[model samples]
Target: MVFTLEQHDSSKYRRKARMISIAMAGQLVIFGMLFSMLLTSTFGNSLWFYALGIVLGLLATSALFAVLRERPWMAEMRYVWQLRQHLSQISGFLPTLRGAVEEDNRAALDIVTFYHAGVAQLATLNGRTPPEDAAWLAEAKYLAEKREALGLPARVERFDSQDLQAFKRS
Candidate 1:
């Protein structure tokens, strides 16, 4: 099976992005107010002190937003980015798995198991389906059954966040 980059719905992405930006702005404002209060308690309430709090708050918020943008839980954008990266690489690995399954190659079955589990895990996390998911599942199931028929263990390990992280590192 061939894999291709699919066009995502821009309207949905834009709506989510706007919501995240608003949340970040609200956090910044709250942080600034808290900082101002802290400054007021520590030192006398002065214009310069309040101004310094706002400046410091803005700097802190900027740094936090930069880091949060890359976090998977922040607005699902990072999840989509990671999913795209995985999908791009899958095309290259999939053909080998397909051949391995067809040839009943035991060594390659490990690769097939890992790839299938990883894709399944990513799809669940992203809340969306990859284009070839159905075909991939069918092939994976066939491979599992073939393994069983040959008196081999058919249990494929489920992939999780840690596995994904490890895969990314490699």
Candidate 2:
């Protein structure tokens, strides 16, 4: 998938995330309480019964929400979930990406560029510093400079996940 450079309003996304969180928390609590009451017959009013009921309820709600999140109302939540996954996958290949850079691999360069830009955007939205190593920060800075020095165009707005095929771990 290609990453877009559109600016996201943090408050808007935060509200969306809060709504989904509230829904899930409500489900967890409601299910937990109802199941705990119902399971008293099979397991009695013991800690084990309470524990088992809560676990089952949690499993049920988790599964339910996993499917529910696909609906249009959950767009913000889904986008955030996907963005985090992309960041993690990109991070896992940092070493290989850095190495690939020396070889002038365009795909690796694109992935790295997307990673830096995306994290910075996320950081802005979350009101925090971008979580990255000094080495990575230096590498990102150096890459931009070198690219500009060579008059190569920046491709920060769009990055394809398929480009990550080159960095798969054995």
Candidate 3:
């Protein structure tokens, strides 16, 4: 199944991307100010002090970026950004992917597999159904089996609240 770009809301993804960009910029500015102030107070108005302040400000910004990169929301933002990028190039990528699939290209198949996984993950996060959930699942299963056949240990896990309740009952 061909997944068109229109199925997902690009506006929402664009907003999330903007929010993350703004947040990162705000963090960098705040950290830079704090570091500059601390450095200025420690060493009066010397040239060396100014150089150290700049260095420290950069380090502070890097630290904040490192910390934020580990956050779940940041990860979600990254995924949204990736989805947006792919959607923008879908017109070209989709046809190439289809051609590759027809030619049995492993790399293309891998890309498709991960694309479906990402779509499913995005849908679940937004509490919506993917445009082709069943097709995605079928493709996922096929890829898992294919990987296993090639001596790769691939497993797919499905979670159901009712299944957990049944286990608890026993």
Candidate 4:
């Protein structure tokens, strides 16, 4: 049973965050260079003054970036933003699948099956699912085993709360 839509890998989000950070760093470097140049021009031939200005600007910018990256809120915002993008892509399918599960529609069942199979493949690729995904893994494993035993292709079934709980208990 797939509980969530296919999300871009966490690595993708991390890379995006890193890219944003790099862009910000570039902006900081540009600001620092501009500030240093302005100070050098204002001081008019004082080498010490220009050197101090450059050092101060670099230090200030580094401190600012350190704070930005270390802030809990910044990290949370990045993660949330990435998740939102992922969900938006598949959000509509969720309700449709859920409704089908509720109504026992065959088409919906097929969709759900396909979705889980995709998720299972991802999980396998990732080496293991996250802790929150334990239940889904269990269900997938069970269905796969059952299908193999029966010599039939496996179909993903909707996992209700009861089904998840039963899987966990075993």
**Each model's lDDT:** 0.64, 0.79, 0.57, 0.54
- Report the error of model 2 at residue 144, Å: 1.1
lDDT of 3: 0.57
The candidate scoring highest on lDDT is 2
State in Å the error of residue 37, model 1.
Answer: 28
Model 1 C-alpha lDDT per residue in residues 1-170, reported as the tens digit of each score: 22222334545665676788798899889888888889988998899888888887898899888887866555456545655565456546566656756777665565566566556555654455643667766887787788888777775442232323323433
Q: Who is ahead in TM-score, 1 or 3?
A: 1
Following a full C-alpha superposition, what root-mean-square deviation does model 4 have from the true structure? 12.9
Residue 96 of model 2 has an lDDT of: 92
Q: Candidate 2 on 63-135: residue-level lDDT in tens?
A: 9998998898777666667777888988989889979877877777778888888888778666677867887
Between which residue pairs do clashes occur in model 3?
none
What lDDT score is found at residue 9 in candidate 3? 55
- Which pairs in model 2 have colliding backbones? none
Model 2, runs deviating above 4 Å? 1-6, 41-43, 131-137
Q: Using Cα atoms with residue i matched to residue i, what is each candidate's TM-score against the true structure?
A: 0.41, 0.84, 0.40, 0.32
Query: Between the candidate structures 1 and 2, which one is better when assessed by TM-score?
Result: 2
